[model samples]
Target: MKDTPRFAPDDRPSGGWGSLKAVAVSMFREEAPISTAHALLKQNKPGGFACVSCAWAKPAKPHAAEFCENGAKATAWELTDKRLPARFFETHTVSELQTWSDHDLEAGGRLTVPLRWDAGLDRYVEVSWEEAFAAIGAELRALQAEQAESVVFYASGRASLETSYMYQLLARLYGNNNLPDSSNMCHESTSVGLKQSLGVPVGTVTLDDFEHCDAVFFFGQNPGVNSPRMLHQLQDARRRGVPIVSFNPLRERGLVSFANPQSPLEMLTPAQTAISTQYLQVKNGGDIAAITGLCKWLIEGDDAALQSGARRLLDAAFIAEHTQGFEDFAAFVRRTEWAEIERESGLDRASLESAAATFAAAKSVICVYGMGLTQHRKGVLNVQMLTNLLLLGGHIGREGAGICPVRGHSNVQGQRTVGITEKPELAPLDRLAELYGFEPPRKKGLNTVEACEGVLDGSVRAFIGLGGNFVRAVPDTQRIEAAWQKLRLTVHIATKLNHSHLLPGEVSYLLPCLGRIEIDRQAGGAQTVSVEDSTGFMHASDGVAEPAEDTLRSEAAIVASIAQATLAPNPKVPWSQWVGDYALVRDAIEATWPEIFGDFNRRFRAPGGFQRPIPARHREWKTDSGKAHFATPADLRTDPDTPEPDADTLRLMTVRSDDQFNTTVYSLDDRFRGIYGTRMVLLMNAADIARLGLAEGAIVTAETAVNDGFHRAVAGLRVTTYDIPAGCAAGYFPECNPLMPLAHHAEGSKVPAAKAIPIRLRATKPA
Candidate 1:
């Protein structure tokens, strides 16, 4: 059976089927009208159809779903016809819904009407928008005596720029930057790391760069699950003889063989194109050691050509001018012995040598990474190490060679570009002050981790979520659930019901809004909303379909109403005017963020959204020395949360099945990896299974021992051995979310350590 490889290596986290095939047969089936809308979504026109999944930008050309398969699932869920009416609210109390699984609650579909629970009735009865808004307004009014920071405004990447901008503006005008955004969960490291290293917290490459790369190195990320559209780029690179090197704990489906539904021949013949040319299975929490080893070999080892490669590799010129603390960093890399690297990374010397040789051979190598590398003890340093590698290759400021952080939200980068960040430096804040004629808050706001902590401490009384499902995105969900309950009120302005929405506050409100596919027909003929893509390119998203309901408002319109009721109106720009014409809001954005936003709309009329100036794109590194210097080295001790070095205590990583993306669950079935009707199955190596005293399909319980003596029992987990390294095991997120404690976040970025959790396994109690 091992020689035959019955499961095709079964390296992908779970599911192997095409994300689209899964979405097409699942989400799209639930709503066929959306199939037509997806085609229009790809057109680079100014309407509201951007991806609802990770922030990897939508393509200039519209496809069936300008989004990926996971995106379709997210959009379908957002645009789902099914509704949770008074009957659903009647049958399921807030407490009951709280007990529902993340999948079941979100899959229950859109919550059309507002709901508020009454203790007398014990059920959430439908409430009018006026009453709901009025109640929320009253609650905020009650907090007038308290400092504004007491109320937290959580932003989602899925929110329209208009909504996000207005939301940020309202928070600032209201006198607190308590903006806890989705960035805190995923790419905070990219933002913090890049800003510290390069003075700008955005990606250095564009979609155009994908075509130019001779080789693309992906680590700790599965584009098939997180950003599957990236598969097209990887697939094309395969045709061009461009090698894609993938380093992750598990082999990914997109990195293995992907049959693009977009390709005619592939669809006809079901021919699968090969992706990752070299697959490196670095163990969980092993990225630091793996990356450091690559640096060591390339710099000092017998593969001395890499030094010349490093000459072409190192932006030495950029380093000399723009960086500091490198001599120390260099010394640190030298001290890291190959033996230590091999043992820690769980990679044989041959494999490491092969990988180093591949990098040496490639002329222009683009190193792309995701959360796995960024949500650890040394996440910030890990990112800098990537730049250091690129810098060593002199890859920056060149086409097809740079560092890319594949963000998950559709407009997450855009949100930051338009000043949605909690940590705004003096320059952006001054710009906002100059453009808006008001002093924007200069104080930094709480990241997602701190925001949750505030909730736990009772300092934050309210949580106003603009879009994302916060609870699932946060680590240590038990702590999050308990903390969120302490809030005086929680108002979620969302398109669908998520698990976070069900984590009830004393008083809660769920407001349904129009999705990107749905046209926001108002006094205007057609309305257009702006969205930023991965590369900091902002484009207009205009909805082609009518609003799902007359009662449902655009996110902008919803925010405007809340603004009108909640705060005293400011005169710089009328909130009502901005809502009526999103262009007015864009004008404000242009004024606030100049140089880049100059001629924003006109520039977008050309190709692939408007391009933001990456200082490095012009060889203008925004680093202090005006060059691209590597970051100061950090001492990344092993994760304190890592289990004791014992046979039973193993490091666990959370991953996505091919059928799902981010927080949204597409289906229980993962066809490609052969998982069916469950998310709790553990993927361990066959050897590890024997070592751990387990058998095939034996149900196990994951017990997480953390502070407060917390114990989370993940029951009915069928142990399925896969081609994984000996010490690492894998499971899906939000399901295993209970295993991660709130304190396990990276200290520098506070990004949740979802990819690495120290855990133990045991047999589940017999049913």
Candidate 2:
């Protein structure tokens, strides 16, 4: 491993010359030029494919160059000239490939054909698509015959609307609702919180809202790495003189100033638009406290401030008219003390008051958050508190004012909208059963956490992953992989090679599928899939580039074919017709979810597509109370109740490197964090490092603080000092995933508290 730890801070993270250089390097590595240029120009456009990196919506009138640097990287990676032929799989054993790094595994190139694992030879051998499908079908049928609930169908956020709809239909028809998805691991908290508070599970704002907002509050998100396209929106918000206040444990580059690559002056010069007007380094797991503190201040203002005619900090009229639980919420806020808030939030009263003052002064505001707020034990409450803050000032149902949850995957929200959920609503189920003569399962199914537990207990006999690297993406990596190995059958439908493919079951198969940027031609004609963005706009995504390999099947085709083979005699749904004409799937979707997806085919072809109905957008609450509700605050007494802190103990947060998106690592270098040629590094506060008697670049190991009597540790991580909050440390995920206990998840959402892992760091003794 290269040991060069560059400590220079990146003044310009995503855009400017840095983005250009990164783009050039990615194109060179992927051998992309004419094909990439042709493909990129169409990405996020009216007649183009959605970017695979993020769920940020395409502007109604997108420019010719609508894609960002990371989007370009994703496009190049998808449209790479390199190919992983059948011979390559034949030459390497599963165990041998397991030794390869994640980047190396993907660097092997795109998968082109179906391959089945041969236990005797310990290698994967090429198999015909028909034979592979037939074998998988037989196993699934056998499992269903014995116990229908013994199978799990997992989906990645990369799944398109048509594919997601088909996958869920197949799962429900196959007598199982064990449809765990990537959302469970990331934004499940957002879904649960929003649904409870605002009567909508998605953000209520559109792309145009950013332009009108006076201030944007970013909590626990690094947009530069997670969603680079959002930088443009932030840049525009900043240019409009809107103050952006950031609340994060770590000082993220994306939350700092950013140089826009699209701007001629900034691109040519060294100037950059400042992103955050104030950056508050809140402690890990302290988001709820911070937000609640702000609310408390807004409710019971300073004596001096109140005397200065700043009495109407809270929108009493809006709260009385459009919200509930104000009295109880205000009582809790008034009772909560400043010392406790300061201790939990790691921010003094001055800072919290300043942020609250900024919000109070603004007429229109948008509260934005990511996994940082959601991946906590109180994740759902964290989200609700933000909504409460917004409701106090009437930040919803108006231009430039609403809640925004920045999703990691390009179509994660879209997948949920199209019924890729384990918890199926009664309306959708009723509609589905009415349209297709199948009784949908009523029992609540296994989520990501429960699925892993099910696999371990030998209850889930078979597993089928639609696109994501499930093993690596979920928490408790080693344990989850071991449980995954216990499966009787495992199948992965994917576009590229991942570690999950190597950790197969007794009967394992890899089914290659077409990517988003590739042509998806069927018997009828070229097909287009629709996806819902973060803002709820449903748009068409048509591939402009040729397939990496002709043998690769569309995700829709694979799902439909699997359903056809598994439910052969008389499938409830028209699998063959759906595969042949994707429009049929859209028709089915519209029939099922008519309220939102009416005329999907006809409307999706419109310039910017159609917006999904959001009652919250129009200040119409669909909740039981018929108004937005202020949910109870999380029990802040829990963390403080723990015995005095140990010297070695630190709060660990699993974070993404700048070179990666989710589990896909584009490179080892984290340019923003100043780490190079390695993923095995821990970012710690400089003062914390000094107190622990550890020098910079010191090799260390972090052990999880779980009382479950199981030892979980990640070793050989080099500690690097940074400007994070004291008692808080951060590290790259998948690498740090092993340190997260599955049981340590949010109360309601079950999203692993990846951002608030209790860890004990120790010096790594020389071997």
Question: Which one is best on lDDT?
Answer: 2
C-alpha positional error of residue 271 in candidate 1 after TM-score superposition, expressed in Å: 3.5
Error of 1 at 759 (Å): 0.9
The TM-score between candidate 1 and the true structure equals 0.93
Per-residue accuracy of model 1 over 1-767 as CA lDDT, tens digit each: 11211223344322234544566676554564454455335534434456566777656665544556676666666666667767888777777777776677776766677777675666777889889888888888777557777888888777777778888887777667887787888888888788777667888888888888898899888887787777877788899999888898886676677877776777667467788888999988888778777777766652354545534434456556556666776788788777888888888777877787688677678888998888786677778788777776667778888788988777777777666767756237776676667887777887788888888888888888888888887777777787777788889888777778776678888888888767787555577777777777777666755555677877888888787788875677588888887778878877877687897656654446777888876667676666666664544354765445577777888877766767777666666566766777889998988887788878889977554566766777788878788888888887888888788887588888877787888876331
> Where is model 2 more than 4 Å wrong at Cα?
1-7, 302-311, 637-644, 765-767
lDDT of 1: 0.74
TM-score of 2: 0.97
Error of model 1, residue 129, in angstroms: 2.2
What TM-scores do the predictions have? 0.93, 0.97
Instruction: Count the clashes in each prediction.
Output: 28, 0
Model 2 is weakest, by summed lDDT over 10 consecutive residues, at 636-645
Model 2 C-alpha lDDT per residue in residues 564-590, reported as the tens digit of each score: 788745556778888989999999899
lDDT of 1 at 412: 77
